[model samples]
Target chain A: MNIEIRKASEKEVPFLVRTIIDAEKSGTSILPYEKIFGLSEDETENILNSILKQNEEDCELSMDAFLVAFHDNKPIGAVSAWIEALNDVSSSVIKGNLLRQHLSMKNLINASKYWQNLQEVHFDIPVKSIQIGLVYVAEEARGNRLAEKLIKQQLEVLQKKINQKEEKVFVQVYHNNLSAIKAYNRIGFEIIETKENLDKNLLGVLPDTKKVLMQLINIKNE
Target chain B: MNKTEVISQLTPIFQIVFNNPEIQISENLTANDVKGWNSLTHMILMSNIEESFKIKFSLREINKMQNVGDLISLIESKK
Candidate 1:
């Protein structure tokens, strides 16, 4: 497929931001930040860029956690993975702190209105698991298995940073994202957990009420 | 505001943010020690604290915060 995947650099901030926005959308048009936090798409992009450019490996949101795939010198796909609980701080705490720093008081206040509802569908990736997220491939670059290549290459990089012998690798996805589910299944990930919330209030705040956690153990064991 | 005053004020914020009226704010309290203290509500909690204290936390300050003691200390210093 002529796809070359490498650790993303600061120069790829724009691409990484797009990949994150797309991945967070989960193949849907609903961008949670905009709907839940009252952030404009541009505002969300700027915040994402701020978080990404900082190069903090605190969570999946950090740019240092992502691997970019390039075909013909243009980025086509990207994926982020991180070992949770570095130095005793959970990725959620680090990520929350990061967002608290960048998000405006106004946005945060607006988020407070919807934040409680987010809890209804909130899914936490355990502290020790290797969480793989923000998996995205450019539309033009699809159908070539670029996502699969990016994820495998990303695992190779993450396996070194993670110290433990056997760490459960996880990816959370909307159950309706059949394409993503199919892709993860191809890579030996199985659905280990599923949470469904049928509340009608989540119509705009979340893309889907049903979410699933996919797990992979020992890439080589496949 | 003194630590006592901060703790007194902070107690309600924590309880309301976590939606647990039974919570008693203590120095040793960490995110793991509190139920419903996950990433989804953390920012809302921070912003609420800012409004209550009328202070903004820098990225470094937010990142360095470890527990309730650190939070009260930071808020006290900021106030």
Candidate 2:
């Protein structure tokens, strides 16, 4: 396969939206995007498209923040990562503000009503650190280091934008996603923090509330 | 309501959401001025503001808010 990776453009919003939703679900049927806002797949897709249409590096939601991996000129998998503090604003602030702006009033009301369950799984990434927000690979492309390639390529892309000393890279994933954790482990990432929801009701809203933060330790500059 | 009335009402909402009673709702105040004004709190604050003012902010309106003054203007426009 002729593998190629590059930053996604605006025209690829549909693919990136699907990729993001899939990454959020993590091989499950429950989509947090829908559950959080009480929106359907179509509604989530539409709002996500509007959010990703922006060219700026607004963390994970920005179109330019995602790197697409294509096998033989066909996009197969993708990953989204960015520096935490862009424009001196926190990543969470950027993302949350964007969501607040784009989501419909009814959806935001739903989110407000059940903010408790959502907050249970919410955590902030460190400032000035490299944050990996979403990752998804096609089933046919499994076990091929495709995820590692996409991530490494994204890191390299973000490396030039960093002016800090000793950059720390972080990726948050559900604790139940053993395969993804194992994949990250192979790429020299280890669990540095874990957050679990003590509220059992959150289970109905999301598949799992236990999230693990993985940090890259042996990242090499080749 | 006037800007003064809006500011007076918003102070309590900001205080409650940010958990910073000392936060003064100045026109130039931004998320940078408050310590706990991250994404989660921002959303919560928006929800609380909508509930207190009984207004639904449009997407464009929310994006236009840059500082406390902008927020006050948006609220006044909605009213």
Candidate 3:
């Protein structure tokens, strides 16, 4: 089987958005927008597509930020990585879009409560580092170390583009997602810290499920 | 080698890597089926399998394996 990993093109935005939604549902099972706003799959896709479209104009969530894995010419998995500071800006845009989508009063309250709870336990991401997020491997394509491959490839690309000072890279995984955490660990990432007491009321997850922050420093060697 | 022989060789490796002697593995068993058989241990398991079977797998071959049965088939083909 021929495997190709490359930056996603604008034509693949719809596919990337769908992959992200599917990955969020299957991998994490923590649907922040879905649970709060009762969004259907199509609704979520529309929102994400709009975000990607906007990204083309301002790069808030550009396709270049994503790397798609194709096996035998079929897309099987994807990962998105960028500088941490970009996320802070893109998140505000996402939240604005959510509000403009006219979320109900009850859902608005729920979103507020969720953000409050998240803010309490959130860790400040380290500066001068590339942050990896939205990691997903197709359900059937799992168990083959595709996630590790995607991560390593992204790291290699980022290392050449950035300076020597910005050598650290990090990824955040849900504490309960042991497989993902373990995958990152095998890729030389260490658990820097964990943010506890994530608001599970809206997410409908177990109380023990916490968000973990893991980092891989010194990617030059690996 | 037959399926039973391959499994018999793999069972001890799984036990040693996962630190669980009672781990029962079947052809259809996956990472989700076995406790502590996560991504990190999965790599270690792959390395151990390669050493035991004296076969090396490419990244494509490795990603294609979905379960013990798939792995056993790959091993058989390599041999």
Candidate 4:
């Protein structure tokens, strides 16, 4: 199969959002995007499309962080990555007036609190590093190393944009997601720390599961 | 269960857990050999295996298993 990996365009927002939601569905059901945002699937898709559309127009904030993998001109997988600092920018965009219009005050507060708790539990990422989030390969496209390729492509793009001092790339996987953890390890990421017993009520909402933070150091050249 | 019978039973577990009906299992088959045998699915596979075999694998045993052969051998020993 001819697999091509490229940055996503604004027109692909719906596809990207659907891919993300579908990917997350295979994993944990708790703390899902729908539950966290307190919005229906359609509403969540609309909000995501808005974010991608606005970011495409302004080009500020790493809003263009999605990378898509296409096989024979059909999208098969996607990975989202950006500089760690962009977290705040993206967060602000989510809390901005546009999203607030669709999201209730209670849902907004819940989402904000959950994110804040997540930050506290995950610890701080190093300065000048990129964080890869929300990686998903289509069910039909698994075991073909698409995830690794997407990550490598994202790292290559991010490495070029960042200064030489920034050499670390990190990703968080749930402790139970051993296959993802193994895949990351195979890709040169090592488990640095694990936050055990995450307050089920506060953030993860999954009892008895922990979040493990892994990082691939000195990836600028690789 | 003997090794052969264990493997016979284990094959379908893998097929069901990975959601690939055509999955063929060999002694050397690792996670790399099958599609959708990711970390998340691996845990699910283990759970299903335990349920089917009516045996529990220790954390160490789970971590030590490097291939399907090792899993079958572990199940044999447990039995």
- Off-target runs (Cα >4 Å) in candidate 2 are A220-222, B1-8, B15-41, B50-79
lDDT of 3 at A185: 78
Docking class of 3: incorrect
| Chain A TM-score vs. truth, each candidate | 0.93, 0.93, 0.80, 0.79
TM-scores for every predicted model: 0.90, 0.82, 0.62, 0.61
The top-ranked prediction according to DockQ is 1
Q: What part of the reference interface contacts, as a 0 to 1 fraction, does candidate 2 reproduce?
A: 0.33
Better of 1 and 4 by DockQ: 1
How accurate locally is residue B79 in candidate 2, as Cα lDDT from 0 to 100? 88
Q: Point out the higher-scoring one by DockQ: 2 or 3.
A: 2
Query: Cα deviation of A81 in candidate 3 (Å)?
Result: 0.2
Could you list the CA RMSD of all candidates, in the order they appear? 2.3, 3.6, 23.0, 20.4
Q: Per-residue CA lDDT of candidate 4, range B32-57, in tens? A: 44544443345456656777889976
What are the per-residue Cα lDDT tens digits for candidate 3 across A78-159? 8877753332222222224323333344544444444434444445444346768678777778888888889888777766
Count of backbone clashes for each model? 0, 0, 0, 3
Q: Residue B1 lDDT in model 3?
A: 85
Model 1 residue runs over 4 Å out of place are: A217-222, B1-5, B26-28
Per residue, candidate 4 scores C-alpha lDDT tens digits across A1-222 of 679988888666777776666555537665355665666777777776665666531111224778899998888888887774332222222223334444554665455435433434444454346778778888899989898899898888887877554577888777788888888887888989987644555544442247789989534333
Checking candidate 1 for backbone clashes, the offending pairs are none
Error of 2 at A108 (Å): 2.0
What is the per-residue lDDT of model 3 for residues B1-79, given as tens digits with 9 covering 90 to 100?
8878888888898887667789877877755456444333444566667778988776446545556788788888887
Candidates 1 and 2 compared: the better one by DockQ is 1
RMSD of candidate 2 to the truth, in angstroms, is 3.6
Error of 4 at B58 (Å): 54
